[model samples]
Target: MVAPLRVGIAGLGTVGAAVVRLIEEQARTLSARSGRGIRVVAVTARSKAKKRTLDLRGIDWVKSPLALANNPRIDCFVELMGGSGEPALSAIEAALKNGKSVVTANKALIAKHGLRLARAAEKHGGALNFEAAVGAAIPVIKTLREGLAGTGVNRVYGILNGTCNYILTRMEQEGLSFAECLKDAQRLGYAEANPSFDVDGHDTAQKLAILASLAFGTKVAQSAVYVEGISSIAPEDLRAADELGYRVKLLGVAVRTPKGIEQRVHPTMVPKSSSIAQVMGVTNAVTIDGEGIPAITLVGPGAGGAATASAVVADIADVARGIRAKPFGRPVDRLRDTKKAPMERHEGGYYIRLMARDLPGTVAKIATRLAKEKISLESVVQRHPEGVDATDAAKKASPVPVILITYATSEDAIHRALEAVQRDKVISGRPQVIRIEKN
Candidate 1:
């Protein structure tokens, strides 16, 4: 019988420990599927004394993660360390240099250094799999790499960050403020204490960069992604979304444009009728639009110890079965350099909210500005403050909030129009602008 596939896992965090337990508990079944027994031979963590639920009786404890990755007895190195630099990068590098297969859940690492690592993996005759890096347990990477390989994908998009989704979901369902919902998310462990990475749309940007490479066969361009967070999404935004037959979601969207590929992560107004709009809480959903297949939406748990571990194990199983492919569905050298479509060139409908002074010509001036930009108005609604009548509106100097939904127009046009409106001093505050996503 062939020797068992020896595995070395670095980091004993919740996901790492769960991976160890999963491999052992499903050893018999895994062996049957892969036609080769899979065994954990070595492991490393910051602290071996730290109590964990998994039993590590027979597994060799390596003092350094890099040493474990370079261990001759190990065929696969599983990296669960959460960072874009240092130990994780070096360990994976060492393992690949030694021709060992690698499985990682580090999105930041892959987003930052994927091209270099992919080249290394190809040159060294080893597989680098990161199924857990993007949407945990969702099989999005696998789907894009294998299932839809023959199809030409036009767009790749999703709610890639669970923390942002959880916060948005709670805010909409409970009518809570963004701060209140974020606090609840943190308490529930859905968000980090310093949630900027997730809430500010950086996390989604990283994941989208990976997906864009796979779907478009373009170079991973994390730096080119236009990012906007849900921090500005107020309760009023949600209320307006509902009234306008839409829902607000922090979406990571990458699409093929005439000029180039467009990648952006921001609060998007999705139609309430769309499938993705229904995906609530911490769940993630990825929609791929391809040539043959119009669109396919894959939804599942985006993160968590077990969910991420499950994805890691799947990649390991593929490695064991010798089913490895290019990291981005195409050879790293063959991946084309992506031309980033400028955000100002983006064409889409927009939801604009302006606090206009209750003066008679204030509303007309706003329209004049939009008309000057050749931006057509889909709808314009002027709302008075609560308990105020039409007569009171004429007498008061307080600003009346006016909501404008514009027809499809370039982002440049909207910006110029809003700038002109602001200069006129008819609006009381900075206007809120949320892009409308027809998807």
Candidate 2:
């Protein structure tokens, strides 16, 4: 009979408890697949006194995360604690240094200290798997790190955040405002009270940093990602996107360019027919663009205990099967450093929404400014107020919403033209700009 793989888990939150339950429920299948039985030997959490749904009758309650990580009895250390620092980081470091395979779902820590942890794992001869970090149950990390090892990946992008995707989906489907959708998300527990991390794009940025490293074999650096939030998105923008046969989504995009590997997270305009556009609700999706192959897209539930724990257990199974791949697909030394890509140099089509003055010459002035910067327009629409004709609306001195879809242009050129238009007082309020990402 093969020996069982003993597991030590830190932080018995929703994910941790579900992981325990999954291992118990899928014992026979796991044993068959891994060639050994998997067991939860010990666990730790913020509050042991706090009642949990899972029955830990046979499990040892370790004093702390560090203790559980260093326990010699446990062969695999599973970390479900959500933080970029603290006992989580030190515990993971200790586990890897002890030559024990480690599994975690903490994107923040990976983004901040991934290379360092990977280096430690390399030197200690242990596996560091974070399949649940990017997209829960999506298998994106494994796809990028192992399955595509022989292929050349040109670009990898995805809707990695459920909170943002939920908010955006509601806005697009119901024609609701961003604020309204966010409030509903919070009430439904899809978002936190603050919601800045997800809404402001930092959460997506962290996940993107990890994906970029795996896809490009570059050092994972969260600071190198250019981030823009979804809070500025409104219902009007979604309507405009529908009119132009596109959809607005917050996407984390990592692509290779002449300058370097560019990683960014922002509100992007994708064609309505694209696979990414069809992904809605709290679901997540990732698209991998490899050399000489069709684009591969993986989609699934991105959060919740069941989805996340399913991935954590899969990582543990890999450990039981004696499968150990490099932490970032490439050796630590071979991973190149990632320099932050300047947003100003980003070249792509743009969706610009300007509240232009309805007076004569206003539209002419805007066109002249764009032309001066060598920017060409693909389409232009002046949305007059309901029940108001364009000439009549101008006579009423109402501000018209001019939506312009521009051909491929540099970010610097678009900003220059918009700035000139603002200075000329031809438009009111700040202009809304969304980058067009072609499928």
Candidate 3:
């Protein structure tokens, strides 16, 4: 049998430790599948004395991650550290420079420095695999990089953040407020103490950037992606969405348009009948709209130690089997610089909910403002307080909830109309606006 494929691991956290345990437990199976024994020869973590499930008795313990990454005895450097900065970047670079293959579950590092890393990996004849960076255990990266390689993918989008998805799902199912759902998520360990990165849509945006590069052959451009979180989504918004036959989901969408490649992460109102809308809780789903083929949607656990380790090990197995491909599905130098489509010019149906003064001309004023922007309203609903007529409600100065579902219109038109409504003092507070996506 061929010599065992030596592996070095950095950051023995949940996923890293899981990978180590999994490799040992499945050693015989992996060896048979890869035509060689997969071995964990070196490992590094913040603390060597930390209690772990794995038997580190015979494994070589390194002081720094960089040392494990640069160890000559290791054939593959597996990085499970969760950051885009520091020793992670330097160590990955060192591994590639030393002609060692790399497998990582770090989405931030891939999103921020993928191009340079890909170039290095290709130049050094080393494999750089990150199937675990996107949708964990979903094979999304493999689907895009292999299964749909020849298919021209025009759009790629999904529920990439599990924390936001869990919050939204709880809010919709339990009719709980955002804060309540967030607290529950934190308690359940689905969210971090500082959850801004996941809840604010940066997490989805980073994943979207990586997917966009593979789907469109464009360079990763995290900054170019427009982002909006679900922090502002209220129970009323959920009710309104249900009333309109839709479900509110925080989605990361990227599509190739005539203007350019458009990438955005935002709370979207998808048709209730759509598959993506059916995904709830911490589960994730990705849909790819390719040319000349029906849309493909892959749904599974988005994150966890075991799921992420599954992807990481898959990448390692491919490396062991001598299955190497371009990091981004094409030569690094051939990837095109992404041209960002202006979000202001994006045309889509919108769900706008406002708290309007209960006056005779209030609805008329909103209609006129929308018309001025050339926006067409598909439906207008004025909700009054229970046991009160419009006249009595107006006499009491009670604010009425007004919902307007607009026909396809540019984002600029919607913003301009909302600004006009705010300036006119027709709406009491900021309006809740959600983009409506078909499928």
lDDT of 3 at 59: 93
Q: Please provide TM-scores, in order, for all candidate models, with all chains considered together.
A: 0.99, 0.99, 0.98
Clashing pairs in 3: none
What shift in Å separates residue 248 of candidate 2 from its native position after superposition?
A: 0.4
Off by over 4 Å in 1: none
Q: Report the candidate with higher lDDT, 1 versus 2.
A: 2
Global CA lDDT computed for model 2: 0.95
How do the residues 1-439 of candidate 1 rate in per-residue lDDT, one tens digit apiece?
A: 9778899999999999999999999999999999898999999999988888888999999999899988999999999987999899999999999999999999999999999899999989889999999999999999999999899999888999889989998888889999999998889899989999999999999999999999989999898899999999899889888999999999999999888899999999999998899999999999999997668999999999999999999889888898769999989889999766789999999999998888878889999999999999999998887888866776786888799999999999999999999999988878999999997
Each candidate's lDDT (Cα)?
A: 0.92, 0.95, 0.93
Query: Highest lDDT: which candidate?
Result: 2
lDDT by residue (1-439, candidate 2, tens digit) is 9899999999888899899999999999999999999999999998999988889998999999999989999999999998999988999999998999999999999999899999999999889999999999999999999899999999999999999999999999999999899999999999999999999999999999999999999999999999999999989999999989999999999999999999999999999999999999999999999999999999999999999999999999999999989989989999998999999999999999999999988888999999999999999898888988878888876888999999999999999999999999988899999999998
Error of 1 at 45 (Å): 0.4
On residues 1-439, what C-alpha lDDT tens digit does candidate 3 reach at each position? 5899999999899999899999998999999999999999999999988998778988999999889877999999999987998889999999999999999999999999999999999989899999999999999998999999889998999999899999998898899999999998999999999999999999999999999999999999899899989899999899989999999999999988778899999999999999999999999999999999988999999999999999999999999999888989999888999866778989899999999998889999999999999999999999997888878898977889999999999999999999999999978999989999997
Question: What is the TM-score (0 to 1) of candidate 2?
Answer: 0.99
